[model samples]
Target: MEQILDLETDRENQTAGPSGRMHLGGNDLTVDAGRVVLDGTVVGYLYENGFLRSAREQTEDDEDPDTGQWRLVDDLEGCDFQGTTQDGLPLSLPGPSSPGPTGSLSYNGRDYQVMQGRISNAQHKILGEYYGGGRFVLRDARTNTERRSLDEGSVINFSFAGTASDGRDLSEQYTRPLYRDQISYHENEIIRYFQDFDRLDQQQRDYVIESMRIWAASGILQIVRKKEGNAALGNVKHGAAGVTRVRTGMVDLDAEEFERDIDLCARFGPLAVITTRVPSYVEVRVNLVVSHEFGHQLQFCLSQAAQDRIDELYQARLARSIAKFPPPSAYDGGSELVHADQVMHREFISGYAKASVFEYWAESVAAFSFKESRKLLRQLDPGIFSILEQVVFTPEKVMSAVLCEQILNLQASLRFGGEFGKNLLD
Candidate 1:
């Protein structure tokens, strides 16, 4: 097995192992400008968060016939640094910079050689450059300067700096590996936004909209209700139907508890699942309240795993409730839960709810939409032969008794006793 090591806490100066530098205990080394520090010798496989930082070595001058200009000779043997953007966009390096001639390089399987040339950005044309052996050309459209050289791969690292694209000056800082794409934002902006928001009265609908956006920036989804004609609700898809606000909440209900909450609200999926903060009068800062609402949106968009427990509870309840029905009767070839491929998803059908699994499961899970609950009921009582036929149709062949038995067992586990079942039925 390959050994793993942390350079931050590991002791340095120890005899090197197969993993390269055994370990190092440096007091959080700070890199200054133009300083290169090696964490450990480049060994088997080295990974760094940033890019390699290095100074470009000056190349000797060579004469180009087309431009009749003296230019730096291309050196492929030297190491080069490569940096990637935030979304991993790779920018071309070794291209011409301003005030220089254009160049190209040819790769002969193992080596790369440079072809000298120049291009004019204004004219948008290559002046004069012939390729003898080099295959690739990198041109900086801005500056005519370029180089052609032989290819020799060398180790490189990641590095970067931070400044807003809007031309705001940022404090200069360097992190290794040098080629890493790091971004920094002004901290003062966040502080200012927060202070201004806290002082607002929640009664104003516009304040709720602004607050929701701010909360979203902080990764919180907030539910807010605006009085009328608020711009916040104008552009959102499905913004109407009297359901003004839906946001992700901030509270961290334990995984088990979250499952229980979902079961309780199985009937109100459309409504925002929130903390106990709503009041008849609007007075709180809209942003803070909206943060909780946004969380519900996030919860609604959860993966199947997020509700695995509730799904399991539903399955168990189905099985137990089936035990009460005789074989080849109401329980035998019933709803999709027993027949169709039932994978956990937000959509709830009928039949399953009336069977008793849904009632207890609904209460256990938190806020559910009545629409979903009613849909579950519609499935349970198909009303006529047409709906019943839909449920029992064997799109595939016959369902083995084993499959029915397995499902029944699952339902039994989810069945609730006494008052819990009564509350759901009521």
Candidate 2:
């Protein structure tokens, strides 16, 4: 959530400590001016009872008058200091004794516990830990394996537990569809029948919405639906004609068929299809299918440069597979040849990712959304991860201007009922 704090008013009421001095190691610090100094540099301002406000210099480019010259870096009530003991162990606050078993730290509106001197979630799984000299080691909560080590000031992207950074429950925000303005065709049809998002059961709805959230920044307009049939689990149509559509066929599957589908996906689908030992119905049917189709939509709407990069990666993967197993003939064709090629590509996330470059892209998109699958994708195919990170994954650079314009033109054309309508009117 956005919070606006008036620092000037806060500073006016600020009080000094009893002795106007503090001790740290051998240094005798003076706080008579309420400025926190370290190595002769004023790092922050100190308030009564050890509250701290970080120092920030306002540049000429900063035009926000309300923010002014001095900004409140973090919530005053929250802990802003990370102190180290004489033994060189990290501490959340400056105190003689270490924090208790239930000690927690609040950052960016989220609360994280300090378990045995490590950062943990509500489940008590270690997310990261601090060491001496401003070092931190981040670990994958699921595997408890080290992902990377970072400095104190470095930013790490993590899917923290409970509410989004905006202080809203992400699932609830997704309950009602977002970016409806982008949907220019088949709106009534999408909402009237079984395709309606509300028609899905709670479990199915949750999975589909979660998947949609992954591609929210792609700017690819789509019609998502829940269908009932045995013909196919899910599919997307994003050809030059007609509106782009995505549908999942998991609404009426029986117990046997559902289990069969799950097994089939485990062998040929994205990693999220079977994240754990036993996959849930929602994970197999909704998360996998929706994310995969949206991946296609992303492909259709991305810039030519981005698409070329994707094709380049796909060709490289195909070349590697072909190198391992020479094709039977230059004229070889059909599903048999595709299956053989897929088998040769040992690094593929799933059997289907070897089907074609398009399938590979879609499968990677689906896998990258989940933590377990994301780690697997990063390890098995760092090339795809790099491209995705540059174009789609990064929040600030999600889509280029040309791609955004293409989406706008598509939306405009779709709303006008396709190209033939203009000719007919003329």
Candidate 3:
């Protein structure tokens, strides 16, 4: 049976658990621990090893009795239990509630996979009792596991100088080569996204502003204008609408060229403006360009599994390309896609996608996030849509979800901090 989660629920009573019963995998679920409040009106669960963790786990000094790998921490005081599975599925534990020996989250008539809690923290506002061993953790919203691997460092800003540093120490960077007009345009665009600032929490708001700060600091966002009479109408160092590096995050946008393309799109059609095979049913040119570049930036923020999955898919596509577009063969052609086998062109969003896995990912992410274009992309390529829905966009990819949460958190943050918003190659 295809399980559909109820998104619209009563916010006040919305955090209730097994109070209303539900079944998963043909099994019965019950509410053992009652509802407790977290800050910001968030409520959480406290169930035994039913779905989240094993009852046999440890809870002593810095040891997650369940895994015994990392030090099981017991500082659950006023902390949100955000976590995810290793493969990028999200799991929720009860709380701002204290930890207990056994715990799990029961939501919408379903038991979300979560770590059973032990109250090691002090007290709740209403339920004044000592809680056990729930540790402070950064979590993936959808998938849950007892522990996370400490391979990729925490998601902080990357130094434009190719070094990584804890937030406290890094020197600030600037948006390179942006002229007065360009800078204002960017600041205005940044502010446009920030217009909904009140909708976000302090953290989300901080993230948006800080993310911009990092991009600006990284010496990225180099902008150039193609003059009206410049004969080279379509000159790009990298083939697509814009280009950026996997690590450097350097991005170059042809504002004049793009403006020219938009004008052409109006005169001839949107098809004349876009490089991808995706049909021009709407404004897919300029918007898609910005979204696409953002997609590349988003790629740097994802967790290992999410990144791996992106690489895996791109490699699969690349493997086929290597076969079809044999080196220096009869198919060697001038245009990016002319050399591609029929299958390559058919599967990708645009002809630009055929150039590289990075390009394909960037194009798809742009298509996905850009609302007006999403409908056509889904219709044209359902398979790609499914992968994006199930993997990259899942709330369980913790690092990835962090981006979403901050974006969502902007609401709370605005009243409180502030905000946000893909990609890969094999």
Report the number of the highest-lDDT candidate. 2
lDDT of each: 0.25, 0.41, 0.34
Predicted structure 3, TM vs. truth? 0.37
lDDT of 2: 0.41
Ranked candidates (lDDT, high to low): 2, 3, 1
1-426 in candidate 2: lDDT tens per residue?
Answer: 011133343344433311244444455554434455667765455432233444555344332323434332133233344432222233333222222122344332345554323554443233445332223454422222333454221221122223322344322111113324333223322333224466556655445444444333222322123212211223323211112223333232233433343445446543423332222211222236545554655554455666677778878877765665343454232111323224323545654565577777877776775555667778878888876665432312434454443333322222212221212111
Ranking by TM-score: 2, 3, 1
TM-score for each candidate, following the candidate numbering: 0.20, 0.39, 0.37
lDDT score, candidate 3, position 205:
45
Q: C-alpha displacement of 419 in model 1, angstroms?
A: 48
lDDT tens digits, residues 1-426, model 3? 010111122123322222222222343334223222223221223222222221223223312224432222233322233333223333243433334333332211112222233212111111111122112233222223232221111112111111111222222222223222332322433433333435645644443343333222121211101101111212343334323343434344444544544444345532223333322211123234444555565555556666777667667766665565433433333223433234324445654655565676667765665344456567756655665554333434423554544332221111110111122110
**lDDT per residue as tens, model 1, 277-372:** 222211101112222223233323333443354446566545644563222333343332322222222222333232333232322221122334
Q: Under the 3 Å rule for N, CA and C atoms, how many clashes does model 1 have?
A: 98
